[model samples]
Target: MKNFDTDVAVVGAGLIGSATALALRQRGVAVVMLERDLGGSRASGVNFGGVRRQGRSPAQLHLAARAHPIWADLKAKIGIDGEYVRSGHIKLARSQADLTALAAYAARVADFDLGLEILEGRAFRERYPCFGPEIIGGSFCPGDGQANPRLVAAAYAQAARQAGCEVIERCPVTGITREGDGFLLRCGDAVAVRARRLVNAAGAWGAGIAAALGDDIPMRFDYPTILVTEPLPPIVSVNIGIEGGGFYGRQVERGNLVMGGGFGVASGDGASRPDSGALARIGGRAAAILPATRHARVIRIWAGIEGYTADKNPFIGESANVPGLFHAFGFSGGGFQIAPAVGEVLCELICEGRSSTPVEAFRPDRFQQQSAEPGRTP
Candidate 1:
């Protein structure tokens, strides 16, 4: 058996974890990153890859804004463009109620300087003629866009490795415990890691680490599916999303349209399959939202496991129970866009004992407090 000692041990190698390691290494910190599978091979690689700040809840906008510049400088940081583009993101409203909600959201986030434009009637149709008749109006964030998710996470991991972070793949941690003022991570009998601090970024499996630390986090697993259509003539340049959460899609430069909505079925043993019914529903909705894609042949369908907290907001702070433990998981399915900033924030907390970014809203122990409140279920 081999033993490794480090200043910090990161428990996952997804975009968030890899980014954290990269940032920590840049600051001359001794860090070790462990992953069960190849880095970025899980939810981080299979997501829709929308590098968007639109359609996010108000509380999440700040973090999304923080990540925007990182995406802009992605190539310089990770050494690959990752097929990222600022194709804009439009949230369509099919009904008056949806339009009202979208308008409210746009107004609420105006202070964030998103420069959102709400268009309807001829103005909306003239700009985006590919949208179907059902799309009454839309709020557009002109700077938002999409990227290739499969390439991003892995690129971050590679950059972290090059920057002197010890990345161990296919080494799943079986358990974690507090020893003295540090943490001891056991990866079966082959390897053991000891670190002064621990970061839980294991996506859907992060709850297990929290549990081992005596925290009963109310986290659940979700299998969200994405469908890709065979290359067709480019129809939509901007990424599209529904106001009330029905469908979301974007066309890549190669002419393939990527669409996703709803959840899939978990196929036991930590695997999941795309739900056919949900895919069909997504197709119907896409046909109504983007008529040009109605006949586009679907070439692939896949799903990835993600962790969602009760309120859908992620846990992103030091543990209330364990002083040396930090968490950056349970982002529902909207984490890709904000992951870089999260890594920076985590680095701030670890090295400086605080962060300038507003992370109080993502307390890891908020659910515990919620469950203790009257009639509240976390």
Candidate 2:
């Protein structure tokens, strides 16, 4: 059996894992990243790439606020463009009720210094005429934007590699065993990895990893479908989303509009593809938001499996049942934007034995209290 040793063993080379590995290596921690497929081939590489804090849950605002600066300087730190653009993010409201919700949300996050601008009626139309007449008002966050999901995870993994981190692609961890204050990770029956610390950044497969270590987190897999239209003249300047999550879309520099809504189907083993019927519904909604999209030819449509926790918040920080093991997963669909900050947080937890950010609400054992109840697992 082939054996290797490292200070940290990170499973799943998605954005979170790659970012964590990169951060750990930068701190001089010997790190090894194991990927089931090519790094970032899953949800991390195939997400909507909205790097916004406007529509996040209250629990996520703190992390999102901390992540914003990191994202702003991502290109400089990663040595790649990653197509990150701070073109701003606008969430439209179709009715007075939706507008009220936006106002309440803006008020709630005011203390966080988000500076959300609320626009209505003539002001909204004059600033953003790309929308259909149905849009009544909107909330805009100038600092929030979008990035290229296809480029980010792989870029972090490559950067980690250049910084002396070992990244093992196509290596699926089949079993894990405790070994003298460390972990013995078995990939198939041949390769073995012994590490003093472990990070479960497995995205949709994270629940299983947590369960293996005796922490049964309630996580569900969701397959969100995304559609890309052929390049058109730039019309939508800001990343757009409708209140209530009816639809969301953004135009890249290449002029193609990437949009997504609704869920698709996935196989038992987690292989997923876009649902034609769902894609049709998404296309109709996209055209409704921007009529020009009705004429734009769709060039690609795909789906990826992402984990969603019961409360729609991620599980971060160390495990309660196991020592020297940490978890960061179940961002629902928002992990891509805050992944870099999460990596930094993980590094702090591992290296300094605590995080500077207030991550108490994201503890891995939060679900344990809910799971203790009979016939229900939150």
- Model 1: lDDT of residue 374: 22
RMSD of each: 2.5, 2.3
Runs of candidate 1 with Cα error greater than 4 angstroms are 371-378
TM-score of each: 0.97, 0.96
Residue 294 miss distance in model 1 (angstroms) = 1.8
- Model 2: which residue pairs collide? none
lDDT of 1: 0.90
Q: Give the runs in model 2 whose Cα sits over 4 Å from its true position.
A: 371-378
Tell me, by TM-score, which candidate is best: 1
Clashing pairs counted in every model: 0, 0
Candidate 1 displacement at residue 40 in angstroms = 0.3
Cα-based lDDT for every prediction:
0.90, 0.88
lDDT of 2 by residue, 126-172 (tens): 98888887888899999889998888878988888888888889889
